[model samples]
Target: MSVAVYIAVMAGVTYLIRVIPFAMVRKKIKSEFIKSLLYYMPYAILSAMTFPAIFYSTGNTVTAGVGTVTAIVLAYFDLPLIAVAISAAAAAFGVGFLV
Candidate 1:
């Protein structure tokens, strides 16, 4: 496919992936279990994205990884997102440069 067509198709698929879930469940979600599940969905997604970086190293959890530990601890305070990103990036780069 051409570059434009490839981008368009990927965008359409991405939108559909997001929309289809809610559209399919809107009417069927009438139970407390589902409601509670949906309520925590955003937090769960955030945790899923954030928590892994802290614990999982190349293939294992490295508690001594100061960069990962620092990032995770700061994340609990609700500081600005950019600060967290920069700190994590700096931690990684600083350690790599020194080693």
Candidate 2:
């Protein structure tokens, strides 16, 4: 198949996946539980998508991985987030030199 056709088909499928859910849900009664579920769904999805980057590594591509972990730990203890992130990134780069 041509590249244009492939792109078009993928785009159509993507649109349908997003549109069908709203169309169906709009026709039905949404409970408070369902409303809350929908409200927090994007954050859940984003976290799910970002979760793995906190650990896995192929080589020394370490900053995004360990940096995220460090940021989370420090933030949990009420540390300044920007400082934690900077420290994590520098630590990762420094660790890469040792490894």
Candidate 3:
């Protein structure tokens, strides 16, 4: 398929996957357990999707680890998102160059 068609199809699929659940569940969910589960679902899914990429995005796992640690430290300190990202990339690059 052409790039535009592929992107359109993927966007439709992603949109449907996210929207269908809300369309089906018109009533407010009453179960606290289920409500809590739904509240945390996005964070859980995001972490699942992102954590593995962080470990493999750099050329080496060691550098990736350094980057991940740097990001976590910066985030813990409530740094801005851009600062966290730039510092993480710099840490990874610096470590990669030195090693």
Candidate 4:
């Protein structure tokens, strides 16, 4: 198939996926449970997509785990994002050097 055809198919699928939800739901959602699920869905999806990559990013699970732990601990203490990131990276790099 040509690239244009592939692009068109992808665009159509994306459009349909976005449109179907609106077309099916004509009124405001009222269920508290469903509302809570929807509210947290994006964070859940992002974590699902991102969390596993953390484990494999350093090419060594031990370093990756140490980095993840460092990041989590720093985040728990409300450290700045830059501090958390740098500390995690340093922790990973230091572990990678040692192992």
- Please give the distance, in angstroms, between residue 47's alpha carbon in candidate 3 and its true position after superposition: 1.8
lDDT, candidate 2, equals 0.74
Task: Please write out the lDDT profile of model 2 over residues 28-84, one tens digit for every residue.
Answer: 655989989989999999788866755653245565566666777887888886788
Error of 1 at 64 (Å): 10
State in Å the error of residue 45, model 3.
1.4
Top TM-score: which candidate number? 3
lDDT of 3: 0.93
What is the per-residue lDDT of model 1 for residues 6-83, given as tens digits with 9 covering 90 to 100?
A: 999999999998999878755566799989998999999988886655555533343327567667777888778889
Q: Rank candidates, TM-score, best first.
A: 3, 4, 1, 2
The residue pairs found clashing in candidate 3 are none
Query: Sorted on lDDT, highest at the top, how do the candidates line up?
Result: 4, 3, 2, 1
Model 1 per-residue lDDT at 38: 85
TM-score of each: 0.56, 0.50, 0.75, 0.65
Q: In model 1, which regions exceed 4 Å deviation?
A: 1-10, 17-29, 49-64
| Deviation from native of the Cα of residue 24 in model 1, angstroms | 9.8
Measured by C-alpha RMSD in angstroms, how accurate is candidate 2?
A: 4.9
Compose the digit string of candidate 3's lDDT tens values, residues 1-99.
699999999999999999998788677678999989989999999899878888999869999999999999999999999999999999999998788
Q: What lDDT does candidate 2 reach at residue 29? A: 50
